[model samples]
Target: MQQQRLPLALFLSLFGFACAGTARADAGSARLPDWRVSGFGTIGVAHAGEREADYTSSVMKANGTGATRSWSTDVDSRLGVQLDTTLARRWSAVLQVVSEQGLDNSYRPRIVWANVKYQATPELALRAGRIALPVFLIADYRKVGYAYPWLRPPVEGYNVMPVTSSDGVDATWRWSAGPVRNASQVFYGHSAVPLVDSLHLYARHGVGASNTSDWGALSVRVNVLRADITSNIGQDLFDAFDAFGPAGQALTARYAMDHKRMTLVNVGASYDPGTWFVMAEANRAISHSFLGATRSGYVSAGWRWNTLTPYVTWARVQAVGATLDPGLPTAALPPALAPMATALNAGLNSLLMRIPQQTSFAAGLRWDLRTNMALKVQVDRVTPHDGSTGTFINPTPRFVSERTSHVASVALDFVY
Candidate 1:
């Protein structure tokens, strides 16, 4: 069993008592105490049509359950709070906190960001404390779903890398050239997570940099980040799949996964002309390899008009050797269980050999039902790059058998 630890006591102790007393005494300090507090929420349910594939966690499947379900409807439903404070001349601070079903329904108030800033000059600023790496232009506003025209950011692309956040210090630089506005950031930090064996997650800590440019109708951002991920369990992901089946193995060798540091490169661009908006991004991640290092990427485009925007997305998830254990029974099983065993074995083999490449075709629509509130509907048809996505298409005892998951939802989001 994996045990998750929350380092909240430290944060709680400092959340209020540590506000710099001197900042309150400055000339315009009274204005600083005006707390602009806001609440944002999303109440949604998704239906996952996995056609009976067992799903242990929604985080891995589509929506929240991913695609390992026979039938599921809700993805990730969450809520959050934010505080924006202007602490005297050219200085400001922010804190955004959230609670969500993470790492197996372990709901905890994760401090998304807690930082202070001082604008030394209009174009330069210094900041310290925990901060989220603004890998994407929308990364900072991810919690504000109303700002986006999608029922959900395309999971096939947006979630390839966990939202990279860390305990560290960083700086920002903003400037403009002719019709282009530019901003750049550099940061360094240390990050870590808890739990291992049977269940675990690798949290890495390192330094990174990002830059963005806006030129009239064109906007672009490029980010480069490197971190020494701890790996799912400090074991070769492939070997772990084989030896770490649910039954648990004898537990052979275990070693930390390091790059020295894993590096990720991403580039994004968007074009808008009032009535239409088109956007896309491409990313590549490379790290050490026992089976051999791996690379993955995706491309997507969307269009918007008024409050109703419809999109067509096609994406492929490629893994050279990322397959884990298929949870299959050994061969030579009784006749009654042979069919089940065979299915498991095949799924396990493909996963182990990296034989499965997944392709998806999806269409979605988002409607701004009201100010700060919206409703969305989408449908996706998924096909395995090889074989039934590594498992037998079985009828889920608890849910109806469906080849595709149809999802629709209404949500209210506000920032005040």
Candidate 2:
């Protein structure tokens, strides 16, 4: 793994973020009721209209029915808990925990966020420790709204670069820009991402920054991020496609390539004018997309008619194979693959190209039953652009998929 650490000196200077004003002060500050706790959870079920359409996590493959139908159910359901306690006159501590279907069906607990702070002032925060990245303006609260008309955020764009947290120091500065409140962030840090068997990400170095503008119920944000890949991150996936051969030289041109840098720049906007709302996000990555240079965008609109809200959303994503070593499998099969390679190629050809592309048309409904709870239902038509007529090529019948599947998802969300 590639290893790089900033001098402990920067740590000394960044620790103990000092804020300007004290959230807890006077009798209110020292009151015994100084601590507050809240929690939220979701229980939901969804069915894909395809027998071979499996659920979204790795766990579904191992534990679920593992069938062409009713395969797995881990999508919109999640749980979270947060606690805030005042530490001193103007300092405090916050901790949050979340459990959800993540990274391949491994139900893991992510600290989500745990930090100590000195509120030197409300307008500015000098926070250190492990801080969450402020990628999208709503990225922080993307999960809290079962009240959201959509069963989930548009995945075509949001799913491209979904990183949870970073280990580093961050500065959150909030001020006013005319009628809007503005928040900006700058962060430098080391991210410890689990290997998950990918050779390239066995370890990684992450750096990113974002800016947000909030005017009334509308907010807009843009972010830029770059990651330096120093090790063999995800060679196995290539191996799956027969990219690597007995000769390791097939992997990289340089004995060691310079840190592979992945950069992302995204712009997102959302507006809620009471009874009406509109949201759109567009992101384009350069030399760092899933296949590199992937382009994705989503647009959604909703209207509240009393307690019920109806919405529609559209999204598209495309990734072409450009960065990979063309000499590998898709380009030429190694001798070891021989007959199996021939069979694999034949089967893959029958299934069409695997260049990643997705277009979705979704319709959703939301009902607010109470002040703290809401019910949401969404149905989406997801079309995979690989041109494979159906899921699971006849050869790999085990890998079943529906060429087109209607996904119906429903969930209950609440915070108390």
Q: Tell me each candidate's TM-score.
A: 0.74, 0.77
Model 1: ten consecutive residues of lowest lDDT:
247-256
lDDT of 2 by residue, 1-416 (tens): 12112222233233333222332244345444257898887777777665543533122122222243373456666888888776455566666677776544565655666665555687767656556766654567665655356777776776556555566667778888689898888887656544344523421456778988888998899998777755543333334443444532433332232365767788999999889999998888655322346678899999999988899999987755442332335335456665554554453343223223668889998898888888888887877664432211111343432366677888788889
lDDT of 1 by residue, 1-416 (tens): 11112324433334344355435556464444556888777665555545344321122322243335433333546678888776556666777787665553455666777777777799998776667877765677766677766656655455455554676678889998888999999988766543323544444567789889988888898988887765443244335434435432311221225334567777878777656677777666655432223333445556777777786666555555444544445454467766755554454443344322345566777777777777766665655443323212222344332244434333444444
- The candidate maximizing lDDT is 2
Candidate that would win on TM-score: 2
Alpha-carbon error at 226 in model 1, in Å? Answer: 0.4
Candidate 1 residue runs with Cα over 4 Å from true position: 1-21, 24-32, 54-74, 194-202, 231-260, 289-303, 320-356, 387-416
Q: Whole-model lDDT, candidate 2?
A: 0.60
Q: After superposition, how far is residue 362 of candidate 2 from its true place, in Å?
A: 0.7
Candidate 2 segments whose C-alpha is farther than 4 A from its true place = 1-33, 55-71, 104-106, 195-203, 230-258, 287-291, 320-355, 387-402
